[model samples]
Target: MQITASTVSLTVADVAASQAFLTAHLGYTVQAAADGFASLTRADAVDIVLLARGTQVLPPEQRDRHAAGLILAFTLADGLHDQEKRLREAGVEITMPLREEPWGERLFQITDPNGVIIQFVEWATSDDT
Candidate 1:
């Protein structure tokens, strides 16, 4: 199959809040927007779609659902610490402080306004481990 692109759609109680958070902090730009929906994109990151909770476009069984227990993660090739510092300088709350794992993973997390966890990760080299 030939897949061109991918996007993650998040059903949030406040679509605007999530949209704003992504655009302001994560460097996402609005690709499109409507009363209850918004499409955001970043040049080198995953695209995001924000849908209001209970949006009519959703199937009846899923219309009331909200994005919970989901961690949208991005794996960066480098600069994890610099990115964390930039986020902190911008006043974005760091839900999970920077830490390194025994498995050579360095990461941190932040909670969006709607409580969706966003994680940034970088793998450590053998020397750094």
Candidate 2:
């Protein structure tokens, strides 16, 4: 079987906050939205769908702790620092400032409302801001 597209949905307490964070920091475009549900997609087809917990998916406790551990990881084809600047300008708190991994990749991190850690990485130097 071939997996063409995939989306990981999160049961969120506040849809607006989640939407705003993703849109403002990561440049995700809203593909669908309502009072209880929302879907944000990136140009790379990465999707972040938000739904009200206990109504759309599981309870708050059942959410994958993976989000807290790794949260979400996004690869940046554009300049990593520039994106960091934008997120910072939007008042988004960055937990881990831009740092280079020993593996030779440039990466940074932030946390969402629920304390989910989000990661951004650049694997190549071709991306110049």
In order, the Cα lDDT scores of the candidates are 0.94, 0.78
Residue 15 displacement in candidate 1 (angstroms): 0.8
Residue 23 of model 1: what lDDT?
Answer: 91
What residue pairs clash in candidate 2, if any at all?
Answer: none
- For each candidate, give its TM-score against the true structure: 0.96, 0.78
Question: What's the alpha carbon RMSD for model 2?
Answer: 3.6
Lowest summed lDDT across 10 adjacent residues in model 2 is found at: 62-71
Candidate 2 residue runs with Cα over 4 Å from true position = 56-67, 124-129
* Candidate number achieving the greatest TM-score relative to the actual structure: 1
Number of the top-ranking candidate, with lDDT as the measure = 1
Show the lowest summed lDDT stretch of 10 residues, model 1: 120-129
